[model samples]
Target: MIEPELTRCVASFHPGATGVTGAAKLSGGASQETWTFDIVHPSGNVGAILRRAPPGYGAAPGRAAGLDAEATLMQLAHDAGLPSPKVMHVLTPEDGLGRGFIMARVEGETIARKILRDEEFAKARPMLARQLGRVIAGIHGLPQAKLPQLRSLTATKEIEDLAREYQSFNWPRPVFELALRWLRDHDPGPSSEVTLVHGDFRHGNLIIGPDGVRAVLDWELAHTGDPMEDIGWICVNSWRFGEIDKPVGGFGTREDLFAGYAEAGRKVDPDRVMFWEVMGTLRWGVMCCGMMQRFRLGPDHSMERAMIGRRASETEIDLLRLLAPRGK
Candidate 1:
């Protein structure tokens, strides 16, 4: 049977919409979820996506930029002509869909492997880094007055947070400790100009197509901080997906990425980006360790978590490359 409540909800806001069809879960966990469906209308079927915390899950967990904030960001980005989905409707209690939003869907490949290896993206690959740079510039330049409240982060604060999380693991990795020390010694402190930082801006969060980046997705970790953090994050080795030589998302050069940013009237501090690169590497390593911890002691233990724990060594190698590289 069709979801009568959801159909009524769509009809309330979607002009000319008769109902909804093809409702299906895309992905989610216990607390939040994503669903794909079509808004049936006399004009045509409209592809839309639903992101929600369901009914009982009241607020997003630590550091998440709650669903409401996410919707606002997407709408802001779309309005600014950035490659983002347009928010269709924000769910209300009467909708019976819980807390979340519906947005027009943009189709593309988010898998790093295919984006890097597939011939379909061959032309797009070379253009991605530069295009993404411009997109990020747009994101950072969005009118602050119109933006929603988000967590403000600084390099010093980030380093401290990462150190605390790493220490909690209690599993000593001299490399991680060395990296941690290096970050403290080189912390850039407060940026001269802070803007919106898409906290996770690589690989899976990007939607790539034959034409290049079709859209940027996932704003759960969006925050206010150094823009360079986005640059460094996209350059992280894990996101390279085996193409280590090309630093800018394994598809283009840092020079190209920076050039695009510069063309957009923004300055790029290479030194600061380098600093965050190391920090991002260490951050991923620590996260892998956390995965292992959860696997060892959790109600959600799974093989993927176990395997990811083993991948911690991957970060270790990447860390060494960053902190103590062997001379060529």
Candidate 2:
């Protein structure tokens, strides 16, 4: 349904692009979609990706940063040399391809299990934690004036949001309650430096190659808040797969991550990072339940959602380790 429109769309933007080919839907729901296709050009074929919200979804409902905002952020990140895909064209009404933008596709493995166990990424594992740290610093340093209007989030507000979402499910989770209490008690107040937070900075969103992280994807959750939240989210136990010992995405230590961040001339607040780690763990747990809720009562019939929901208990174990660890 998108090829004919897509063909015309690319030709309108890319001077050399004659058309598009091999269009295939990568992922997403009815409202949002991701498609992969190659731009047929006279010189050579160019890999491209399209992220759209069909035509009728309206503006990004709820917390989404919107497709237009995503395009701007990706372009800004690319301009800042943060290993993000180069945004090529923002969809116009005349394109008839819905509301979205096109980006040059970066080749890499986004699968967590593959990047963790595959021999190709073995060398990169040790360096990723620190490298990602620097990337986060760069993101935090993005000039504020050029930034599109986004929600300004605080730790307290995020906690409240999570609590509301969890409460909406009408299922009482004891561990979740405990976490909510802890988060409120340990609220670090407002961060000294308010910058762009890459709302989701863990496994699947990172495009990794043999050398290192090739690109960061998904800016729909980007907000203005504590940059350290990014660090804590990556260190969440859910993201480490089975490598619990290696906290930094199961690759390296907090020391390495801090070292990389410090190299960017930013101070590391250990307390804030730890707090966010707890928050991230609890957030992921709540998200699992939310995903399951969607699966049980929505158009999204994804077994993956139900499977993820089953992992909600994993966060319980993680919370115990963090909030009430036994002597090692």
All-Cα superposition RMSD per candidate: 1.2, 1.1
What tens digits encode model 2's per-residue C-alpha lDDT throughout 1-328? 7889998999888997888899999997878999999999999999999999998789887888999999999999999999999999999999988899999999999998899999999999999989998999999999999999898899999999999999999998888899899999999999988999989999999999999999999999999999889989998988888988999988889999999999988988999999999999999998899899989998787899889889899999999899988998
Residue 149 lDDT in candidate 2 = 88
lDDT of 1: 0.90
For residues 70-179, write the lDDT of model 1, one tens digit per residue. Answer: 99999999999999999989988888878999999999999889999999999898888889889989999999998899999999999999999998988889999999
Q: Which pairs in model 2 have colliding backbones?
A: none
By TM-score, how accurate is candidate 2?
A: 0.98
Measured with C-alpha atoms, the lDDT of residue 272 in candidate 1 is 96
Clashes of 1: 0
lDDT of each: 0.90, 0.93
- Model 1 residue 273 lDDT? 93
TM-score of each: 0.98, 0.98
